[model samples]
Target chain A: MTASVLSRPRPAVATPTAAKPRRRLGPGRAIPFGAAIGPVGLLTLWAVGSAAGWLDPRTLSAPWTVVTTAGDLIANGRLQDNLAVSAQRAGLGLAFGTVIGTVLALASGLSRWGEAILDGPIQIKRAIPAVALIPLLILWLGIGEEMKVLTITLGVLVPVYIHTHNGLRTIDSRYVELGESLRLPPGTFLRRIVLPGALPGFLLGMRFAVVGAWLSLVVVEQINSTSGIGYMMDLARQYGQTDVIIVGLVLYGLLGLISDGAVRLVQRKALSWRRTLAD
Target chain B: MATHAGGLTATRTVRVRSLSRGFGDRTVLNGLDLEIGEGEFVALLGRSGSGKSTLLRALAGLDRDVAGSGQIEVPQNSSVVFQDARLLPWQRILDNVTLGLRGPEAPQRGRAALAEVGLAGRERAWPNELSGGEQQRVALARALVSEPELLLADEPFGALDALTRLRMHHLLRELCTRHRPAVLLVTHDVDEAVTLADRVLLIDEGRIRVDLTIDLPAPRSHRQPQFLAYRESLLQSLGVYQTEG
Candidate 1:
């Protein structure tokens, strides 16, 4: 075992022989693409049941009716306006939460005094539900965009804070030693070592923060709002516009899928180094 | 290049004196003193827990816990390569080699070092993509690129397969010949020590037990009678070798 293993030098890495031309798989791509057929089939079954009078079309509107009502809402400009308002609220809230949470997490993760002063309060804040604070936020900030943004920010902050802190704390000690051995200045060390090392976890936390922002936006908008998708859904329910409600629901789901997909694309580009482990 | 940049002639000797270190309830080294000349390769060979690593760390100024009076003055700062590669997982291959350099010409120097280690084309590869031997080479490149006056290596090639280990030993010798850093290598392998070092110092029970200087030429044969005799002497001094009747 020893002699044979020791005798062989490392094999040379195979060089690429040629650049293969790209081939288009337009029709051939349809098989793996059709893997989504199961969810589409379920939606069709629901729509058929509702249309054939076996189900209440009033509550569970047929797919075609939902689509038509969505088109009407879009034509009237109400859907776009509501969507813009909700998106603004979620975007602002996520920005606020991410900035504040990341700063606090870095301070706590690196300094003993910061952790001592902040950990107790952070633990208490994490234990309480963000939705339960709606009444208090409304009392303080009034029933307006401030209240909605505050609620969403509160929801997003805790997860980002936890994940960022954990990420910073978990950087390998060897890296710190390496920096020390090099005699790098403090600012250079933090910039080159600490920030880059903690990035993957910090970005992961931001993704969770984005999702939390949407969830909190729904609850906040439902509670009180003049505009936004959740408020539109509430308005539709009062008038018993079941199709309009379904339209609003479908739009919300689509917005969520798009937001999550955007985060995933960013993750792929930033963390291509992580692909080997994923495989 | 061996001359100081300020036009002052570089000091040629490394002076380490009265070094001591210990953890709570366990003393590792006591009052160790040694002076190494410039361009010297000294191998510290010993059993595990025999204070070889501790002494190396103390000499490198990595152990702040030791309560002892030791003055080590070299022309420039020291660099260490541990048993593990300790390469940053995020950085590309060339970046790992350039890790500690703090000047404008770092990338060019890094490429030169990588080329010296026979890893010229792998600069853009990720750390995980490289084999174990390649990773060790990167670690060596990182240590060597600084052109440190003193290099402290603690079993740096311990994880390599024997053939790779032999190649790495040869590479170290070649680099030392050109750059001429005073290197102190700690290893458990006796043949490795006998081949690589101009001098071998065996540390045991927190003290230097054996100090011998070899006048053999570079690329000396392991099969030579003198080489075998020195190997036997070292093995016997470590109390691990039994002769045939």
Candidate 2:
């Protein structure tokens, strides 16, 4: 038994193999082209349809008409002014909602009494979509900047609370034990262990919050007397200016993509220590 | 209680009197009393539900949630190394070692401990970058960096492959010899107990059933007659007697 077990073949170390050189237009390089194909294809089809006079120009303007209208809006400074207003609303709402949601999540997540007291109301609030609160908000705050900003804030709150709370609750018990064994103070434990452990969830929540912020802005700005992309779209809808409406939509898409990209960059930097299977 | 054994008069690093712990209606540790002398290496052998881990957790003050009545005297400064390395996934290797530690010399001591565990130049690497054995080595470095008086290990090498387990056993023995910290190693492996511990304990039904001293020389060999004798005795205590036709 001794000889056989002792002389058993050891597990071999994984040798570092020379990486095969990637081929041109490989799968890695093909992703961007694949992603762009659908949008580009749709645009080309629109252009062709318009050129062939197969589609009604009044319903959907040609792509070039939308581009020139966008240029006109930009030259007249309406696009910039409206875009600044929308940016301010989204930024303010996102900041306030993120702060409130994170604070609530931390309070409830860390203490049992906090969880018992706060979780029920928050869960109920999550169930009632933020859009449902628009009528009440309009009544209380009027259809002004406060109402618009508050609508976005309401939209941003739920995702941040849910994800961040889940992250805090699911921290590994082993780490908590380590904290106890080391006799770490409460502040140090929260700062060093709890916060960092909960970051992934917080970041995930931020992604959802970003989308929510934009959606709420779209809904709120459409209500009354607003200077934003949504307001421009509403005005264009009245005049049947589909080209201007499309420009507003394109700007919205661009902003969404840019904001999501920024969040992804932050995620990458913050979670640098993680080694996933893809790595 | 102090015991004079084998000419050494080491103070007790751990003392438990009438320690009783239960989960719901089931008792895991029943009125157990034990003592571990300073710098002594004690290996505890037990079955799956024999409360070996419970005892270790209790000594490490990690069993406060358990329902128990006992007087447990553990040193204020003691460290625990679990089967999993439990390094924070977000921190660098050196930072993980120095976790929960403060003072100007912490980084220096952390680096020194990493060097002692054969992980000298890998300080900036993340925990996920290391292999299973290497991570366990980092765990050891983390535990020893603080210079704890008692080190509680719950099957620290149980997850490793056989070859790595052997190497870990050698490394643990060396570390114990050098640091001279009282160690309580809970494991199911009989050979591991025979090879590494100064004293081997068999726990059965939440009580110590066999307490035997391994008086073998340093660098103990499995082929030795005395080593086999100890192994056979331990196996018998665990109710796995060898059969001869």
Candidate 3:
């Protein structure tokens, strides 16, 4: 898709910032059971290795062992508690970041002065990785849930702000003219033109933001922590519990997959008008 | 049909005097003057850089900030159609038609307008789902839906294939008769202007060079002796003297 975009020069009207045009690209082919093939194969290999005693349990836990360990942790309620804590942190961070990012994007995207003031700082923030600020955040806010959530929010905000802002900037001038000719009031103009035009970019940013949230959560939970799957894995590492640590890894992977899927589903439904290469 | 004379004093739906617009040291429209009486269909013929669109934009008030000074007066409820349909892709067909319109009656009016344009029962279709002609039809539906006193179309059918353009021309004439809006259609096609317009204005050097009124009978055709004459004159006006073949 990027290659096609790079090779073809769009008309002067579609500037560089226009929500990446994927015009008339037919819905791509889907393979039967394609998504499941890799993971299923990996699980099968792990089970086979464990059953055949070829894999050392300390170094690598079997798929079944990890599952049972997860079950054991759940039965003891420690897993549920830690899972709840992790969920709250990530959810709060995502929600807070989304609101802040969107509002900031609107302010900056709509006005010249706002852009001059906010864009430079935001771009600077984009350059500084969220995880890199952990030490400073820890020193300022202490190693609490606030610091963790703040870090995740910072991680998620940049993509949302950047993409949404870009979307705002690149709305087709034709539509602006149409709105003006029709004499649409300011509210209708923003609701009909500005919001919908920015949606594709906003949704694209969200896909990145969700992943960023998980990325920040993974690192954030490890900071002098008492809870979360990350903390569980840390504790397991001290005791050399391979199965428990594997369970933690799997949980993080599953969370990342599920949240990303949810965001994608919303993106598809919201911007159904868009004909992109994605399913 | 009683062809409107230059003296038709019922109402001038549009009038512009000494309109001037420039683009970075290059003037596009130079002291242009124009007028269209109520319900009159005027076709503007000009070469690519002849400032036809700039004038239309000025009339539509889309270039209020972009264009230079002009004493312009047009109906407040005028609508415009561009070369592309310019339908909001995200909105459904019905929504696009009723876009800026309000009140409970707007939807009913939108539906009626769509039906008039032969697109009934397509209210739920997406703009992208439709063929190029169909999208332009929706654009027409939207333009006339408001019952504007004036309609400014900037090559609305320019993107269509020849057959579709013909169909649209028929639709446009029929709709204009029913709605009775003063129409200013900008086009490069001489035949299109001679066929559909009550009057054809040839624009050159940012001003109207020739304003010729059509006194032809109904069901205008290419084979008509007057039609051929009008087309020849318009082609010559645009600087193409004759066909090589």
Candidate 4:
């Protein structure tokens, strides 16, 4: 969790000119602008080619078609309901994964005995493909919401656990010396030194967990679901409703974008110390 | 153990008898004996691989493997300042200054410490935001914040440029005079040792090779011929010849 790379100081801001207006663009500016470039260019090319009949419309629907269909889905209240279901599953799974992963990682990092007990088991489990566990999870939990949540939890836990453990283990030895020299109590050391030291890594793990939760939710929902975005995609695929599939894909991408944005915001707030170092 | 049990105005604030230390098979300090009196500033000079650092570490109680059952009974704990500032990178300047304090009451104490170190306006600045000299000051503030009865500095200003080092030496002398802690500074600079220390202890081949007292006034300048004479002698003891000007 001590991946210090992400918080690297941004390059110095460009100097202002009298003819040019300026606005503050800190870290998040790069993300949205960078993300917009590819999709916006692709959409522009598609719209121009399709309108000029250089591209086939019968098979490949236009951007307007995707947008209109999204409207239709929303009008029926189906999109909101499905989004609500997917969010519920992902939220619960993330809560479970982060809590358990952090606790286990701390134990492994702090104690040799805990590492001995956990290392092999965690290694073996990490290699087990999350998708392959779907059948086992279904058989054990009967394809209920619990199974979906558990699947997402499994998908999210390893990265969080490994990152957290590494972060905790890799703290500078000098901090430990400082603790000893100061004669800090065990609880105070853990709280004041260990936890803050591990925070950068922990936040990175949460970012990974958010993305993992989304990926796991889609896969889990595809297997068996009464209501969710993935379920809608599955139903549309059976009926050759490729347009619906496109809509669902767009929604999923947007959900990922939004969640990642949220996580980055939290990262900035937690690491506001970075602002002081920026030139 | 370099602590001594002598009363006020004791012959030595610290005394080490048959002290030895090693890491596994590599012995750093070999049966070294030393003594330092109250109100005395002793500079320990050595080559890179010599045991000067080990000796300082032992005096600070940072080394558990020091040989011999010697006694160290200082009035209180010794404050240590290391080579690299070693300030917690995540902490603000003020917070770093108060790094030794135990509780929530440390903020006010931290600010006061920063003010004492001439860094009053930088309380909220992060460690990386400070210049090299400023960072060293933060480290000094942290060491001095607790009002330690003894100060152990292991090349604390080794990373600084010459001018900055001079300023720091004066600041250190002023602070030591004000606080009057028995100071043991380890340095490779011959002039620095002769200028700042009331006494200089030269460690070579894991033993004290020379112990010479420097009789100079407070805030002694390098321009004084007497100071230069002592510097030349100490440099000669280290096998360096003073160039005739």
What's the number of clashes in each of the models? Answer: 0, 0, 0, 3
Worst 10 residues of 3 chain B by lDDT: B1-10
Task: Name the candidate that leads on DockQ.
Answer: 3
Q: Candidate 2 chain A: worst 10 consecutive residues by lDDT?
A: A21-30
- Model 1, docking class: acceptable
DockQ of each: 0.31, 0.60, 0.62, 0.27
Name the candidate that leads on TM-score.
2
* Model 4 chain A weakest lDDT span, ten residues long: A24-33
lDDT: which is higher, 1 or 3? 3
| TM-score attained by model 2 | 0.91
In candidate 4, residue B92 scores what lDDT?
76
Sort by lDDT, best first: what order? 2, 3, 1, 4
As for candidate 1, its clashing pairs are none
Across A160-239, the per-residue lDDT of candidate 3 in tens digits comes to 99999999999998898889888899889999999999999899889888878887888988768999989999999999
Residue-wise lDDT of candidate 1 within A89-132, one digit each (tens)? 99999999988888989899889999999877988988888878
DockQ of 3: 0.62
For residue B38, what is the lDDT in candidate 4? 72
Tens digit per residue, CA lDDT, model 4, A54-141: 8775556677887888899999998899999999999999899988889989988889998899867887888998899989988999
Assess the local accuracy of residue B222 in candidate 3 as a C-alpha lDDT between 0 and 100.
86
Candidate order by decreasing TM-score = 2, 3, 1, 4
In order, the interface RMSDs are 1.5, 0.8, 0.8, 1.8
